[model samples]
Target chain A: MRILGIDPGLTRCGVGVVDAEGRAVRLVAVDVLRSAADEPLEQRLHRIASGVEAAIVEHRPDAVALERVFAQHNVRSVMGVAQISGLVLRAAAANGIAVELHTPSEVKAAVTGYGQADKRQVGAMVQRILALESVPKPADAADALAIAICHAWSARSAAPTAALTPAQRAWQAAERASRR
Target chain B: MRILGIDPGLTRCGVGVVDAEGRAVRLVAVDVLRSAADEPLEQRLHRIASGVEAAIVEHRPDAVALERVFAQHNVRSVMGVAQISGLVLRAAAANGIAVELHTPSEVKAAVTGYGQADKRQVGAMVQRILALESVPKPADAADALAIAICHAWSARSAAPTAALTPAQRAWQAAERASRR
Candidate 1:
């Protein structure tokens, strides 16, 4: 299975794609979307959305994973973040892709064997697990890869014998036919 | 002077432009950018940035006003919002336009004469101030316009009496020349 992990932000969003088979996971792509300083909010959002869509199309992941939003002290800021999340969710839904949301604690626990691991620790764990030459830079990119790793681990652990349901099987058949 | 207000989001971002002179403010443009659900985040951001750049080029606003990020309990969510804000700031800065950031409460107070005003009240106040046929739609657009109005009021109240300093004058001349 291929999984796409996202670290969504307004200024820069990090995305990572990974292919998982049994216990092995390999990184497919990792990149960031950056917005110019003078761009309007609406315009920036468009660019972000477009970049995400392109990534999804390029990777064609079986599942998409995202970090869930937690509550905040600032209502306005929370609302804005919620709005960003809304877009991310909508984009996933539109693609008819199943999205899995994970909390920071859950992602950390899966990646680093701790629920409250700091960024550096998480980065280290990701580097160790992915066997990368060095840690992913910009922190966001590492977080995105970590999210993908967490999803692969969770899915493998939870569904040893899980396969496509009858409905999903039919849908896949239809999709294959349509593509041909 | 023309001021543009932006309400940034991931899926939909609202933008409003208004002309300000002394105590008077007139609406010029109000629009929202909608992105497809299946699109990539990077692509979405690019679209948003380009759209805002177009608007800026079209309106040639004197200043840009935006909502500031406040503290949030959700670190992940706050980070996402911060990313969006960063893009917006970048867009503005790239165009040599200064930006003024406002808190949600400040925007509410400026638009509705109530720091704790409800969305409806704020919408009504925006309508009243703009003398429009109706309140702006999708709420975000109205809120963006309200931010612009707030800046307009603030700028008028704190109008400068002296002419631009020599350095300021030279900078303005260069900016004007660059545009031409």
Candidate 2:
């Protein structure tokens, strides 16, 4: 399955694409879309929407994984998140693609095996799991990849090749070796 | 000047268009777009976006008046408002139309002369100002008109003909006559 994950925001939105089968995952693309805070709200939204739409058209992922927004301490940020999520959801729908929303905790748990994993932990695991040389920069970028991995794992949990593939085992061994 | 006002919501979105000069305001069209709550979020947003885009295309309004979202007691509702507002803003930007956001208090005060006025008072004032036989049904619809009227009055505040037009005076008299 090919999945595109989005960590939606007004100032900076992160998008990552991954191709996965069974217990194996491979990174396709990852980047952050940024908009200026001083710009008019409509213009900012338009820019973000254009970037997201372009990714969807170019990647043609089977599904979009978005972070589900919940109440947070910062009311303003919460509103921004919801707004961007809405734009992404609409863009995916326009392309006749399905969207799956995963909560922050769910993404963390899926990637790092801990619901309350800190940003660094999640970032490290994503780097190892995708076999990237280094963790994706800007927490938002790693978060997006985490979301995609979460969706991919859940979707393929019942596959016959449930055992860790050679690439997955290699990463797991590397993590263990690094710890020693 | 012509203005298209939107009262953004997920389930029921109110849209109203008006043409105004000086203190005289005339309703062009008013209606509420409804989407089933059971529908997927993406589908619901797409439906609302399409409706708002259609209104903009048909009316060719000079500007769009949108209700500015703020923190509300209901978190879910607040999120919904922001989501819908974002969608509407994007649609306006796509068509090169400008959008002006008014707070609920601003809309009420513009029509009723009191920021703290109740919904009924605002509705009554809107009906009188537009010379309508009765207030528009569903508070959302009336609220949409109120927002447009607010924008119109603010935009024309510096016009040389700021004095009440003949139509405005007639409506003022009707409001006074109805009171007696």
Candidate 3:
């Protein structure tokens, strides 16, 4: 299974793609989508939507793993992140890709075997797990790779989409059929 | 000028279109976009994006007046509002339509002449300004109309998207060029 992970942001979005076979996870691609800080919110969002769609089309990942935005101290920043996350999710849904969101703590726990793992530890763990010589940078890319790894590891325990949400279910069913 | 006002929400988004000539404001349309509460977050967002885009295409409003969600007491609900607002803002920007955000108090002050005016007062003022026999039902529709009215009244003083962000200015310039 291939997983596309996104660490959603307005100024800098981190995306990583990985291929997981059983317990072996291998990295495919990792990049950051950046928009100028001075750009209008709409243009930023538009760029993010396009960038994520392009990534999805190029990688053709069976599922997208996204970092869910929780309430941050900075409302403006969190709002931007949530907006980008929603936009990416919509793009994935439109393209018939299943999307699963993981929290920061969840990702850290899944990746580093500790819920409160710091950035460097998470980065080191990612590098070790993916067998990369160096961690993906600048931090956001590593986070995306960690998110992809988390989803690949935890896919069976996540809440699968129900009947009404056809796009996600379609991807899920297709994956199941391919497995069969 | 015709204004498309949106009260952003995942479950029930209220949309209003109004035509303004000087101080005279007339209601062009009002409706609510509702998504099932149980729908997946991605599908709900996608549906809202489609609904807002359809409204923009059909109404052809001169500008979109969206409510700026503040740090609400409820984080989850506010996050949803922010996400939907971002989605609609992107849609409007894609259509080369200008967007202006108004706070709840600002809308109340502009429409009802009282910043702290209650919902009933705002609804009454909307009916009075639009010459309608009764307030728009479901209250959210009235809130949306009030927002459109607010933008109609305050466009000259609001930020106006000039000197704010380059993308908006660029879109503005392109629009002027196309008109010429």
Locate the minimum summed-lDDT window of 10 residues in model 2 chain A.
Answer: A155-164
Q: Each model's interface RMSD (Å)?
A: 8.4, 1.1, 1.3
Model 1: per-residue Cα lDDT at residue B91: 60
Q: Write the per-residue lDDT of candidate 2 for residues B1-180, one digit (tens) a residue.
A: 678999999999999999877778999999999889999989998889889999988998877999999965588888888899999998888878878899888988899999999999988999999999999989999999999999888743315336668787677547644643
Encode model 1's per-residue lDDT on B101-141: one tens digit a residue.
Answer: 88889999988888899989988988989999999998988
- Could you tell me every candidate's TM-score relative to the true structure? 0.57, 0.87, 0.87
RMSD of 2: 9.7
- Model number with the top TM-score: 3
lDDT tens per residue, model 3, A32-151: 999999988888888887888899889888889999888756877988998898888888877777899999999999999999999999999999999999988988999999999999
Q: Model 3, B9-126: lDDT tens per residue?
A: 9999999999876577888999999989899988998898899999998988888999998865599888788889988888877788878899999999998889999999999989
What's the C-alpha lDDT at position A20 in model 1?
72
The DockQ of each candidate is 0.09, 0.57, 0.57
State each model's TM-score restricted to chain B.
Answer: 0.84, 0.86, 0.87
The 10-residue segment of model 3 chain A with minimum total lDDT is: A155-164
Question: Candidate 3: which pairs clash?
Answer: none
Candidate 3, residue A48: CA error in Å? 1.6
Over the full model, what C-alpha lDDT does candidate 1 score relative to the true structure?
0.75
> Candidate 3 docking category?
medium
Q: Give candidate 1's root-mean-square deviation (CA, Å).
A: 7.3
